[model samples]
Target: MPRHLLKLSDLAPAEARQIVLRASALKRQADSGYRPFVGKTLAMIFTKNSTRTRVSFEAGMARFGGHALFLAAGATQIGRDEPLRDTAQVLSRMCSAVMIRNDSQRDQEEFAAHSRVPVINGLSDLHHPCQLLADLQTWFEHRGDPRGKVAAWIGDGNNVCHSFIEAATLFGFTLRIAAPAGYQPDAAVMGAAGDAAQLADSPAAAARGADLIVTDTWTSMGQEAEQQKRLQAFAGYQVDAALMQLAKPDAIFLHCLPAHRGEEVAAEVIDGPQSLIYDEAENRLWAQMALLEFLFGIAA
Candidate 1:
């Protein structure tokens, strides 16, 4: 069976840590002309639009001497109602690996089950594992191991937050999340994390004494219909200068971008000195390269 990254928990703690370390090394040697993936091809399937995810994966493949094929769901047979299992089997036969950015986690799992090649989750409604890898790499680059650190998540406890909860368990960190009552993360995900994750009464409570602060857009791709309602619900949860100040003096801020500057986060904080959003974004390439190497059984 091919190893797949369907969620953060799919990787053992040590494996995840190793990937981050490898990513850091790859970042340093980015211009060294190394090409482990020569002649290989990665098939990328997208059910939703993307910017960073598409660019980072395509760039990573090109930098490693591999080719990447972009397949929009609507342009492919997938849009014609062909089963995902059939598509997965076909892609697995022709491609070295498969990366999918889709809305349903169940569909992703079904595809992965039928795949012969490693399957990577670009993003799903339940978790954004790839983003978590980049976030881990960025954190490690700036602050070393996150084991004993406190991370505060402010805003809707959506997919990113769910992955962060899993990451806290795997990486041995404490994750405090603050979301409006109806917007809290999935109960089962929080339960699985046990004491590693907790709920705070408010954003201020979550940020207090935290070593890392994070947030994401109030309205995600498929949530456009609920935009105005979300805006109102998340009005007081913005990660502005005041909320950031509640964390430790040297604490860093992270966001899975395409940010609503004045909404989920403040422009000052996102573009501020302590914010590592760019680094976090750039690490997506290196982290994903490391992931590809791991999936293909390539030596670092």
Candidate 2:
């Protein structure tokens, strides 16, 4: 009876758009004394480190008048070899909803399968739907509908790239991803996305005349050991001024934050006038509040 947001494609296109619209509305009324979760609780289980993901969800719950319980996987039985099914069942009983940021998509799937409450995937190796929701909301606010717009993704084809691929399918945008040969997105995901997505051999090629330019770190959280190798592979892929020039003059730039200053993007570009990085970061709260309201069936 409860909805689960395990991936972006889990929602119909209309439903996804509705959530984005709601996020915009919520942002307008952020200080209007709204508290939809006065007597509710949300359980946030984290198996990985976070900055925006943890803060946005926790703050969003507080703003909704709900209590958010932070559970570090290492401090809970989940890290002590307890079965995920048990954790899911226990939390579903005590909490209004459950969120998990973990490495294995299968584990999140198993947890959602047994959860009696709504389940949200905060983060996973396969997809990052929440961030994509915020990104979509930001784009919509600035440029209206993204349908037929060109979105260029330059850098590692990680989870964020994976979600962009799904978004291209759902939102009718063409996504051009430029990554090193060995770092391309999963083949099945690309296959599913079909004509909505394509691969480019270079960042310039992808950015050419694009309406929106986005990128992420060359190395992700769990890939510290391969940092040097990634640096070498992604040597020419940084979203610098030259890359930005390839896109339309007024094209907006975005990067999901905690960005390495001189790595994935140049200092000037991320801090420049064209970057919507800060707005994109702040929208995480508004966008996720809409998701929570949707899952809880609350009308605003």
Candidate 3:
């Protein structure tokens, strides 16, 4: 059986680098119309609606000559019908691997807990492992190698922030996370990232001398109810022209997309020359392909 990658920390820095290198190779082969995962089947379950997650995983599987079975929450007995353990047991028997995009981080743990096969986390409240894979891959591609680079994460320290911190520590980058006074990353997650050089402070403070700076929506999907409150909390946290000026002149800005232009990140920055957001989004496919190749025993 293949090893399950349930979190960014699941792979050591070396293993994570291997994942990216393998993905790049696979992408080249795939782009040239090679298909290696013939006769394989991957099961994807989503309790949350997806844009890139669904398309990337499905397209990535197909790129390798595999089939992806996308299951909606209502189609399966996840939370509403059968227990998660039972669901996991059943799916593990029928599928080579399972990728789940759900709500709680605990649900991901429960799914990985019962499944004997490789269980991948598509997203959760606390982490998004696939994204970190892409983020790392992007950094690797842009800089050819991310060693010794100072990466900064600006704006709200949400789930993406948590996952980014963990990836930073694992990949050995000096990760500086800048959020507002009351919007710091979860202390437990921060402790878990294990970055000796990780620093959390204001956006400008983190941006200084950073090679990569990232931001995400101040208000996430499930937190629409707290939109006003989040706006107030994240008021001056925007990654605008002035803030970008604080970073290294060659520093690149990153956003996970569906960016609320003029809000969390300004329209000019997200669409500007310094932004690598589109490349970051494109890396999602290559990154997940790399991860899926490993989970499916495809030699990543």
Q: How do all models score by TM-score?
A: 0.99, 0.99, 0.95
lDDT by residue for model 3 (21-63), tens = 8777766676677676677778999888899889998988887
What local distance difference test score does each model get?
Answer: 0.96, 0.94, 0.82
* Candidate achieving higher TM-score, 2 or 3: 2
Let me know the TM-score candidate 1 reaches against the reference structure. 0.99
Best by lDDT: 1
* Better model by lDDT: candidate 1 vs candidate 3: 1
In model 2, where is the ten-residue run with the lowest total lDDT? 250-259
lDDT of 2 at 161: 94
Q: lDDT tens digits, residues 206-246, model 1?
A: 99999999999999999999999999999899999999899
TM-score winner between candidates 1 and 3: 1
Note each model's CA RMSD in angstroms. Answer: 0.6, 0.8, 1.6
Estimate the overall C-alpha local distance difference test score of candidate 3.
Answer: 0.82
State the weakest 10-residue window (summed lDDT) of model 1.
Answer: 136-145
